[model samples]
Target: MRASEDAGLRDRRRELLTGARGRVLEIGAGTGLNLPLYPEQGIVELVFTEPEEPMARRLDERAHARSPVPRVVRAPAEDLPFDDDSFDTVVSTLVLCTVGDQDAALREARRVLKDDGRLLFLEHVRADDAAGARRQDRWHRPWRAIGHGCNCNRATVPAIEKAGFRLEHVERGTVPKAPKIVRPLAVGVAVPA
Candidate 1:
């Protein structure tokens, strides 16, 4: 993953976060990788939710050392603890694929966001072509074990739409330095419908 970041995922993260402002909530913020990439101005508050204790601890450590130190919450994406309409922006990068329930997590994100809030996401999804998808299916079991529960074949964009978000923009692409089976990517911004 770090190799992927060094290859191009870092730039993707920067792109996903551009223009983000006001109160922000980032679900599944693994190790605060996006912390330094956030714009230097306009963000009133930044909070991160990570379900894993080890990752949350690292995230908290990294957050405290940053300029706009963010608050770290130990909570699952499927069950965020924030109040409704509290955030201006909600972000999910490389996270939706691992959530136990993608639709539930997206619903939670939508619930916490303000009426005009935006969801910025970058996730590896099921491939568009049948051959590629078959490859994903064939490799998925071992990959899931190696990835610690990350699913390589989830239809995440549709799940987001099913959760009541209207996609405002989307760019189909590939994950840098990742295996082809898990490289199919979608980066997008969605607003509450």
Candidate 2:
């Protein structure tokens, strides 16, 4: 997934994270892909949280080897161990689709973010077409099981909007070489509503 995503997406991730500043928290850090993208000068600190033990260990190892170390915590997105309005930026990348509770996790993101904080996201979402959406739902159970709880047909955009974040920008596209049910993607920034 990482290799294919990088090969296809170009500089989208870099474009999204380079401008991030102040105290930042990234949910579902995975293999710490976003770790190196954040700017060296503006960022004060970075906290990466991952629920999966294996992924968290890898994230720790990756962050440890980097110049500016990030504090990695093993925790689910729905239950972040941070104070209210504690961070300046909250980031999520290719994670919302797999989160067990998308609504709860997003609420947590909003809670931990300062009033002026922004949420940056790159997520695969449900298709716009009706037939494709049905296919996504039809295959959801098995897909989720195989994809580590990922809802290939997840409605990420509406979920984000419903989380009460005032969207600053959002762009939709398709992932290359992926099935139609899992191809739709959304990338953007949002602030607390």
Off by over 4 Å in 2: none
lDDT string, candidate 1, 40-131, tens digits? 88899999999999999999999999876789999999999989999999999999999999989999999999999999999999999999
Q: What overall lDDT, based on C-alpha atoms, would model 1 receive against the true structure?
A: 0.93
Q: What overall lDDT, based on C-alpha atoms, would model 2 receive against the true structure? A: 0.88
Least accurate 10 contiguous residues by lDDT in model 2: 2-11
User: Which 10-residue window of candidate 1 scores lowest in summed lDDT?
Assistant: 64-73
Candidate 1, residue 123: Cα displacement in angstroms equals: 0.7
Best by TM-score: 1
For candidate 2, lDDT tens digit of each residue in 1-193? 7654666753777788975789999999888987877788888889999999999988999999877788999999999999999999999989999888999999999999999899999888998999989999999998987887888988888888899898899998877667677888888999999
Model 1: residue 102 alpha-carbon error in angstroms: 0.7
lDDT score at residue 170, model 1, on the 0-100 scale: 90
User: What does the lDDT read for residue 74 in candidate 1?
Assistant: 95
